[model samples]
Target: MEVNRFESINEGTILLIDKPYGWTSFDVVGKLRSLIKKYTGDKSTKIGHAGTLDPLATGLLVICTGKATKRVVDLTADSKEYIAKIKLGETTPSFDLETKIDATYPFDHVNRELVETVLKTFTGSQMQEPPAFSAKYVNGKRAYEYARKGVDPKLEPVPIEIQSIELVGFDLPSLVIKILCSKGTYIRALARDIGKALNTGAHLVELRRTRSGVFSIEQALSIAEVEKKLSNMCNQS
Candidate 1:
C-alpha cells in the first residue's frame, strides 16, 4: 500500500494542533503539506483545516490530511470553547489587536454585577455581525477587502449560539472569559457586543481555543512535535 499508515493516515488522519500565535491556519496547512510530501513522497496528499483561525489567536486547530479533508464541513460544525481576554474602555476597528484603537469610552460605571448581567443576556441564540475585518465573503471577495480600504460595506448579521460564558477574571478594564459556543460564533464580536451592553467600548486582546468538538488543547501537538512526527515518518518510509 502507498499509505504510510503512520498515525493511521492511510485513508485519513485528524491532527489536533496547538496553533501558535502569528501563524495563520493556512500557514499550518501549508507547512504540513510540504512535510507530508517530503516524508511520504506522496505529492497527491490533500490537506486542509477544519476552520480558519485568525493569525493573532492561538489554540487547538483541527487539521485533516488525505481523505480526511472530506470531513471539513462536519469538523467545522463542532462546538468550540475559547478563553478570551477583552479590554474594556476601548474599541478597535478589527475588534481585536489586529488594528489600532478606533475609539475609547469611560468604563468607570461598569462593575462586576453589570458585567455578569450583560453576559447572561448574551447566552442563547442571537444575531451577530461579524467583524468587517473577518474572512466573510461578500460579492465573491473578502469583507476585509472593504474594511481595510475604509469602505463600509453592508455586512449582514448571522445567527450564532453561545451556550455558556463564564467570567474567569474581573479586574477593571480587563476581563477574562471562558465561552462555549456553537460553530461560526466569533468571540471578538462577543467582546464588542459585551462592551456595548456594558455601556463601554471593548476590544479583544488575546484569544485561545481551548476545545473544539471532542478535541482539547491538552491532546494537541505543537509545531515542533508535528515536525518530529514527520521526521519519524520520513525515517520509517
Candidate 2:
C-alpha cells in the first residue's frame, strides 16, 4: 500500500493508525508525537487526534500532525462506523466491562427477531443519554469523575443520528452488531437502551471503530508499522 501521508508527516499531514486495544487515545498521540519528533528531527511538531476511542476499544484512529492538527475539529465531527459486541442480561455501572456488574436480568425472552425490531427503534435521529461513566462534562468536571466517586452526575441526553444498524450475529445473550452513527452516539448507551427495550439489562463487551468519515480501518497501519516508517525517516534525515 502507498501511504503518501507519512511522506509529508513533518510538513503537516493526516495519519490513520489502527489503535490497539488497551491503549488510550492520548497514549497513541503521545507515542506518535515522540516518534515524529525522533524520526523527523522536529521536536516542535504539533500532533492531535480527531476522535477519542476508549481504552477497551480498538480500531481506526485518525491522527494529525503539524498544521494538519487544525483540521481535528472537522474530522471529529464526521460520522463513524463500529462493530460492537454487546451482552444482554447484565448491566454494568459504566455500561461496559470497565466497571463491575451492577445488576442482572432475565434474557430468556430476547431473540433475533426481537433484536432486529428493537434496533430499528434506535435507527434515525433520536436523543440518547450518554453513559454516566463517560467524558461528558458536568458542573465543570467530567461525568466519569463523579461516577468514579459513586456520584451520578446530571448527564444530558444529546441528539444523535443512527444511520444504520445491522444484526450481524446473535446467539443467546451475546450479540454482534454493525453500527453507523453520527459523531455523538455512544455504543455503550445504545447497548443499555437496547436492554431496556427488550426488558433485560445489557452492557458493551467489545467495540471496534471501523471507519471515520472517509478513513477506514483497512487503510490504517499499526503502531509497529508506523514506527518502522519513522525509523526509515530517521535514517533518511
Q: Choose the strongest candidate by lDDT.
A: 2
Question: So what's the TM-score on candidate 1?
Answer: 0.95
- Off-target runs (Cα >4 Å) in candidate 2 are 1-4
lDDT of 1 by residue, 100-122 (tens): 99899999998888899889999
TM agreement with the true structure for every prediction: 0.95, 0.97
Lowest lDDT sum, 10 consecutive residues, model 1, at 1-10
What is the alpha-carbon lDDT of model 1 when measured against the actual structure? 0.88
What is candidate 2's lDDT per residue for 86-133, written digit by digit as tens? 999999999998999989899999889999999989899999999989
Model 2: lowest-lDDT 10 consecutive positions: 1-10
